[model samples]
Target: MKVVIVGAGIGGLTLALFLHKAKISCEVFEAAPAIRPLGAGLNLLPHATTAFSELELLDRLLERGVETSEVHFYTHHGQFVDGEPRGRFAGYDVPQISIHRADLHEVLLSAARERLGDEAVRLGRVCRSVEQDPERVRVNFADPSGAALPSEEGSVVIACDGIHSVVRKQFHPDDSAPIDHGTTCFRGVTRWKPFLDGATMAYVGTYDTGKLVVYPIRNSIDAEGKQLINWVIEVKKPNDGVRDWNRQVSIEACIEPFVDWRFEWLDIASMLRATDEVLQYPMVDRNPLPFWTRGRVTLLGDAAHPMLPRGSNGAAQAILDARLLAELLATKEPLIALKEYEATRLPATADIVLTNRNRSPDEILRIVEERTGGQPFEQISDVISRGELDEWQSRYKRVAGFERERLPQ
Candidate 1:
């Protein structure tokens, strides 16, 4: 069967790879004129890592990304809250990777070309609309210049288009607009001297007081050994700010909150100032839909379920969707397989969507911030018991479907 996969982002490329492995014929249509590595750092939790490892892309992922050693939490005053080992260190078969968004995209795209052939992905084709019949579905595309392009027919169509998915809008036009969480973020990558273990992902401060997530995405961008550090400073704001991925932000506008962040291992305030460029994006997501598949057409990745990036499950969930959908289509009838895919994933992802907004790994920091009055704690166990911390972390793991105990033996 010929399947048309929309959007060549992480989700679309992964779906193509999975389908290829299943011996299915498919094509990826990307809106972008060229597929280039873009975006900042994306963390692959152990669950998502397992999916990729099954596809045999783990070594290539590690080669292009940093295998994150631990995730650390800190107070606004720079005191350590908690540090936990990730991936295999946490006893999972796969290791978690903190990779540059573009690097991961390249790895997936390169594999698609080598395994599925160069013609597998067609660029500069913007999907306009889709119409499905009893036997086949027709997808319409337009050129970058807005000229009408010939339509293509397929046995099934999957929309992997991201946040602003046209296919999703076509299906759910009356749906509520993306829910804004009243937060604005300033993100960018800068060439800076490595800090800490260099492989650690750190989250500092509180959202009410401005929080920072920092990690090194690349080892050396220049001859001087300066690492490409990716940092994001999210502030609780009254407005959603903006939506453009390439939107430029002034460093001065968001640096006031980090002025006091002078941690011993790294200078958070200085790193923001040293950034080569800054990109601003609003933290927004939609309520999960009841279903992602309709007839011969379905949704995958961000299009299927857009969640806040708080837990680093944005790309991971998308990859999981692709893997699961590919698995279903491999064995069952196409139409029945799509429904089974939804049955297994829609509710699972819906839990993550609601949970991400309410309780995530970082929620622990929120609790500590509230209980400790946002001050330095002489003893963390007094402010928040280790038992409380463990419970908070465990709850999130179970909800995101990555509890260590749930892994296959």
Candidate 2:
């Protein structure tokens, strides 16, 4: 069966690699005029990294990214809350990778070109909508100038077009707008000296005022003890604006909430001040659909389930979707395979969407913050028990399909 994959983001390109390996006839159509190295930082959990290992990309990924070791939690008062071992330090077979999104995209695109042939990926084709007959599906595309382009037909169309997916809108026309989640954020990468473990991912403060998530994406970017560190600062918003990753904002406007974040371990304010550029986005997610398939078309990744950036599950779940869908389509017919893919991923990711809203792992910090009245605690144990913390973390891991016990070998 001939398949058409839309959106050449992480999910689309990876799906092309998987389908090619399975010997399934498929092609990828991208909306961008060119494949530029775009986006900021990203996290690849063990489940996602496992997929890379299977594709023989583990070594190259390790070279381009920092292998994350643990997650350290703290409060605005600069008080330690708790921590958890991640990747190999946690005894998982694979290591979690913290990387620049552009680096990861380049790796996937390179692999796709090598395996699927350079002509397999067609850029500058913005998909408008999908039309289908009993025998095949046709995807219409428009050029950058708002002019119509020749449509392409295939056995099925899988939309990986991202949060603002036009293809998803064509199907779920009345679905509510993206939920703002009451947070506006700025993510920037700064070249600075390493903090804590150098490979640790740290989250500080609750959403009551501001939340800071920081980690090093590159090990060494300079000669005199410098690392390319990625950081995200989020504050409670009065109302949500347009959520665009490419939009940038001034640090001064966003720095007030974090100026006093001078902990013994690291100076949050100074690190943010050193960033070369800061990309802004509104934290948002859509209500999950009961179904993602209408005949031969379906959704994947941010296009299907745009969860909050609370957990590192976004790209991981997209990889899972692409893997499962390609496997099913390689064996089953188009209609049957698309339904199977939807049934497998829709509810699973839907659970992640809802869980991320209320009970994500980061909620532990909020709990500690609220329980301690946002004050510095003499002992973290005085606020929450180890049992409670473990339960809070493991539940989200399982819901997001990255539970250690259940990971595919």
Candidate 3:
């Protein structure tokens, strides 16, 4: 059976690679005329990296990205609350990788082309709509200029087109609206000296005041030995209803909220000033759909479940979807495979979507903030116990399908 995959982003390309490895024929079609190095930093949890390990591309990714060692939580007052080891450092066999979105895409795209041939990925084909019968699926496409392109036929169609998916809209038009979280996030990467062991992922403050997530994506560049540090600032604000991912905004808008965020370990204000550019995006996600499959076409990744970027599970969950769907499609009948993929992944990812909205890993900071009334504490233990902190972390991991014991060996 042949598969037609839409959108050559992380999910689509990874699916292509997995399908090729499974000895299944597939092709990827992307809307953009070319795939360029875009997007900021994202993390691949141990579970996500396990799929890359199976693809034999983990080493290349490791060579380009940082193996995150630990994750730490702090308060708006810059007081340390709790910390834990991650990936191999957390006793998992695979390591959690923190890499630039572009670097990871490069690795996947390069491998796909090498293995599946360059022509396997068709660029500039925007999916207008999809029509399928019992025999086969037909995907209609248009060029970036709105000119019609030849429709492609395949046994099945998988939509990985992201939050603004055309195929998803066609299937579930009533659920097209995004649930705005009433928050704006500012993200950027800056060249700076490492902080807190060089590989630590740090989350500071609560959403009511200001929240900042900081980590290094690329290690050591140039003569001064500065790492590429990625930082995101999330603040509760009225949603402007804009969803552009590359919306550039002044650095002052991002720094005003955290003017006094100068901690003993890292000066958050200075990091914002040093950033060359900052991209702003509305903190938005769609409510979980009742279903993600109908006939031979199914949704994957952001198309299937677009969750808030809270626990760094966006890309990781998509990777999980690709791995599982590819395996099922290779072994089971195409129609049964699509149904099973939805039955398995839809509810699982739906839980993540709701959990991200209500309680995420960062909820630890929120809990501490609420318990202490957002004040500086003389002692962390007096504010929250170690057991409480561990429980919060473990709960999020389990819901997101990355619990140490739950992961497959």
What lDDT is reached at residue 128 by model 3?
A: 100
Off by over 4 Å in 2: none
Candidate 3 lDDT, 77-102, residue by residue in tens:
99999999999998998999999999
The C-alpha RMSD in Å for every predicted model, in order, reads 1.3, 1.2, 0.9
Clashes of each: 0, 0, 0
Q: Each model's C-alpha lDDT?
A: 0.87, 0.88, 0.92
Write down the RMSD of candidate 2 (Cα, Å): 1.2
Candidate number with the higher lDDT (1 or 3)? 3
Relative to the true structure, candidate 3 reaches a TM of 0.98
Error of 1 at 60 (Å): 1.5
Candidate 3 or 2, higher TM-score: 3
Where is model 3 more than 4 Å wrong at Cα?
Answer: none
Provide the TM-score for each candidate, comma-separated. 0.97, 0.98, 0.98
lDDT of 2 by residue, 31-127 (tens): 8889886678989999999988888888988999999999998888877788888999998999999999999999999999988889999999999
Model 1 lDDT tens row, 294-349: 89999999999999888888888999899989999989999999999999999999
